[model samples]
Target: MSALLLDTAPLRSSPEYRRLWIGLTLAGVGSQLGVTAVALQVYELTRSSFAVGLVGLVSFVPLVVLGLYGGALVDAHDRRRVIVLSSAALLVASVLIAGQAWLDVGSVVLLLGLVALQSAAFAVNSPARTAIIPMLVPVEQLPAANALGTLSMNLGVTVGPLVGGLLVGTVGFGPAYTIDVVTLLVALVTVLSLPPLPPLGGARKAGLASVLEGLRLLRGWRNVRMTFLLDICAMVLSQPRALFPAVGAVLIGGGATTAGVLASSVAVGSVLASLVSGPLGRVHRHGVAIAVSVAAWGAAIVAFGLVLLLASPSAAHTGSVTSTAVPWASWHLWAACTALAAAGAADAVSSVFRQTVLQSAAPDWARGRLQGVFIVVVAGGPRLGDLVAGADADALGEALAAVVGGVACVLAVVVLMAWQRGFLRYDARDPVP
Candidate 1:
């Protein structure tokens, strides 16, 4: 039974992997704390949701450009050193955010600028970190390694916001930022302790040429390319999270707390999925697993939309009922949360397969650049989805928007599966990149 649970072989196999994982878990929680602080602080300063939205706009360009170039840098230099430098940059950004809060500076623009810089540094940091995982564990254990990484990330997302809220409410923003700084310093210590990981097959200087070469390789890898496409279809078409507020206001009728429950339900589902992901490590047909998981995600979204559309008219107008005050006996809210949880679980499965495939299929020489592109897609897809879902909700009610989006996502996956027949049959035992 333990063997059927999440595999701990990778942690047992390498002391370095254990240290890296521990440091990253701590740092991830801190990063989430900082993210919540920034959002709350921005709202406090500007008193506008649009200003908070600008955080994404400011961070997007730097993330893309730096993510691509940074991947090339990872391929060219010692990955350990690159990660160390990026960690330092992250620490500096945390300090600056804390300083601003402590000094009572009210410049939203400056705060956004620092956020953008932090994001750019993150783009560089993510690829190097991902590209290092395969180096730390054996080939057969790649799936377990990816699952562990996913577990840490999901844990951070699940717990960090609550911690941040508590800290900000009682202590303040300065303390939240200080906590982030401390976490980063601990993460840096782990990076410094790592053995040097210079690129294999001689160092190719990071330049436009190196970036292009990575792109060229990616373009030819059919299975890897399909993973990105499938993820985009699922995220861009079916992710209705940006509409949670509206759903809570008009459809679910629990107001802000209801919206928060809907948002957090996804994370709850994801964490649960990760906890029992032991069987996933042994599955070999990764491409099919990804496709099936995404289809499940779309189906869950469709069900969720239908639930909203079919609710009692009186239930929709019960706005006086706050989410916090609502009892667990509230069947309607539980149903909705259950749907979101199912969607989250399906998405987590897809993510694990995608990460495993990317790490295993790509060669050591080109892994960093491909991982960089993956980072950009992961970050940008939901932002784009928000725009699409928002516009659709405005034009056609939120319920209908969600339904249409889910249907579209399912159809897109069908088309991709048909077009990339090879991807569906791809075997982990004999990966081809």
Candidate 2:
């Protein structure tokens, strides 16, 4: 039973890690609340889903542009100081968001600008925080530590939007944003307590040269590079999120509510997987584990697509009726959710190993920059997946699109494994990056 449960060894072994984990979890929830509030406010102000989507665009741009720079900054300075400044920037952004809402400024541009600032801060803050984990915990415990991190993130994803919606709908955006401000402050205080983490050898100047130096490490490090490639395969080729709205309305008959349920199912699976990830820390063939997990994700997605096909004969056609209430008794809905949950679990497992490999294998000086790139791949891959999934659904029907994507993802993994045979033999005990 202990082997099957989540390993709390990392938390028990390191007080600093425990405090940092708690702070990150709270701040993650708060960040989600702010995201939900901002999206809702945009919709209320403009009544346009497209306008709401612009929020993602603004956020993504800064994250991509600054993510590497942030990592460079981490490598160049005391990581603790970098985190403190960036977290302060996040708090200031949250305060402005709340102020604007309270003042009834009602400007879409202003709201977007604030979101960009928050995203830029996050771009810097995340890499520094992630890079510090190795410094705080034992090498053998990296997987467990990463699993805990993933658990917290998924928890925020699972809980934040629901609470944010309630707060915004019942009260107003101000209260939601205000709560975020409080959470950010907590995060800031926790970071302040962390000891100075100066660069080990000597700090490189944080500039384009430093950033490019970090990027160059990827060229020589095949194992670390494979981690990014596998993740991209899983997220880009097999991700089925964009198809949720159509799947709920037409094949599943649940409408927007159904879409919400389907979307949340993934996070639920992630949380459950994290809870039972104790055995993952003992595994040594991390590369093989990553491949198998990604393959499982593809298989689960394929199962989800088949369930959709089985549920409705007219699934390929457009203009179907959408329902308000979920058909709780329907086997198709249950099956589809189960498949999505499985995919989520596989994804969570893959993520633990991937992060462990990156953190364990990369040199400390380059960890921050690599983590920045990791953040970019993590954030950007899903958006690209949305575009790919949407295009495929439009041309080939959602069910077939999903089927094609799953197949593609599995095939891509196979090809990658064949090309980099060494990746399959990568042992965690002797990390090679």
Candidate 3:
């Protein structure tokens, strides 16, 4: 049982890692709070869902534009310094958000601008922070460390929005933003305590040349590249989040509340998987683990689509009060949630190993750059998935769209494995990236 639970070896062995983990977990919660508050505020001001969506647009643009440059900056400067500076920028952005809210400035434009600034700071801060993890923990402990990280993120996603909604409903947006500011202070203090972490070997000046240099290295690092490709396939081809609203309304016999529940189900599975990830450390063939986990994710998604298909015949009756009022007891709803939870669990496992491979196998000098590209793929892939899922649903019903997407994801993995047969043999004991 002990071996089956979360491995605390990384936390117990490294005081720095322990502190950093705590701080990051707290900050992640606060970040989510701010995000929720901003979106809600935008909706309140403009009363348009599109305006709320524009927040994501503004945030994503900065993240994609600055993600690589931030990685280059991480390689060029002291990682600790880079983190501190970016964190400070985040603090300033949060303050501006809070200030505007408190001052009763109801400008959607200002709010969107502040969100962009926050996203830009996060783009830089994330890579530096992730790159610093390898320096704090031993190679063997990378999986556990990353599992803990994933757990933290899922927890934040689970808890933060609920708290933010409550605060926004009761106190107002200002208090939620204030809470975020306080959390950022805690994160900054923890980061400040870390020792200097300059680039390994030598530093390259941060510029386009340095960014190109990092991309050039991917040509030789087949295993590390494969990690990103597999993740992209899983997220882009199999993600079904965009279908949640329609699923709840038509097939599931519920409204917005059901959609929220469906969304939370994924995070619940991620958290549960992370809690029982102790056994993951015993596995050394990271490449095989990732492949199997992604395949499992696709399979689970297929199962979810099947459940939706089974429920489709009842769409006409779903609008009746009996179905919406008591949707929890509906077998179809439970089955769909179960399938999504399973998919989330598989995704969490895949993320742990994929992150481990990238952190442990990549050279320290290029770790930041790789991590930067990682942020891009992780952020961009889901958006693409949402687009594809939406379009497919429009063309061939939601259930069939999900089915096609999951099948494509599985086939993509098989093709990748066939093309890069060496990736399957990649061993954690002898990382070849």
| The best candidate in terms of TM-score | 1
Ranking by TM-score: 1, 2, 3
Tens digit per residue, CA lDDT, model 2, 1-433: 9889998888999988998998899898888667656766775675444454466667777888899899999888998899889999999989999999999999999998998888888899899899999989988788889999999887775666556655664677788889989988988898788888887787989999988988889999999999999999988787786676566556776544455466667778999999999888888999999999999999899998898878773443232212355577889888888998899899899999999999989988788899999987786566457667766777787788889899899999999999999999999888889
For every model shown, the clashing-pair count is 0, 0, 0
Q: Over the stretch 1-433, how does candidate 3's per-residue lDDT look in tens digits?
A: 8999998888999998988888888888888777667756764565344454466567767887788899999989999899999999999999999999999999999998998899899999988889989889998788889999999887775566556655665677789899999999998998888888888887879999988888888899899999989998988788776666566556775543455456566767888999999999889998999999999989988998999888864645443211234377889889888998898899899999989899988888899999998887776566457667766877787798889999999999999999999999999999889
Q: Output the worst ten-in-a-row residue range by lDDT, candidate 1.
A: 318-327
Deviation (Å) of 394 in candidate 3: 5.2
- Give the true-structure RMSD of model 1: 3.6
Query: Compared with the true structure, what per-residue lDDT tens digits does model 1 show for residues 152-215?
Result: 8767666665566456645677887888888888888987889988887877789998888888
Question: What C-alpha lDDT does candidate 1 achieve relative to the native structure?
Answer: 0.79
What stretches of model 3 exceed 4 Å from their correct place?
33-58, 94-114, 161-182, 243-257, 309-327, 390-401
Task: Give each prediction's root-mean-square deviation over alpha carbons.
Answer: 3.6, 4.0, 4.2
TM-score, per-candidate, Cα-based: 0.87, 0.85, 0.84
lDDT of each structure?
0.79, 0.82, 0.81
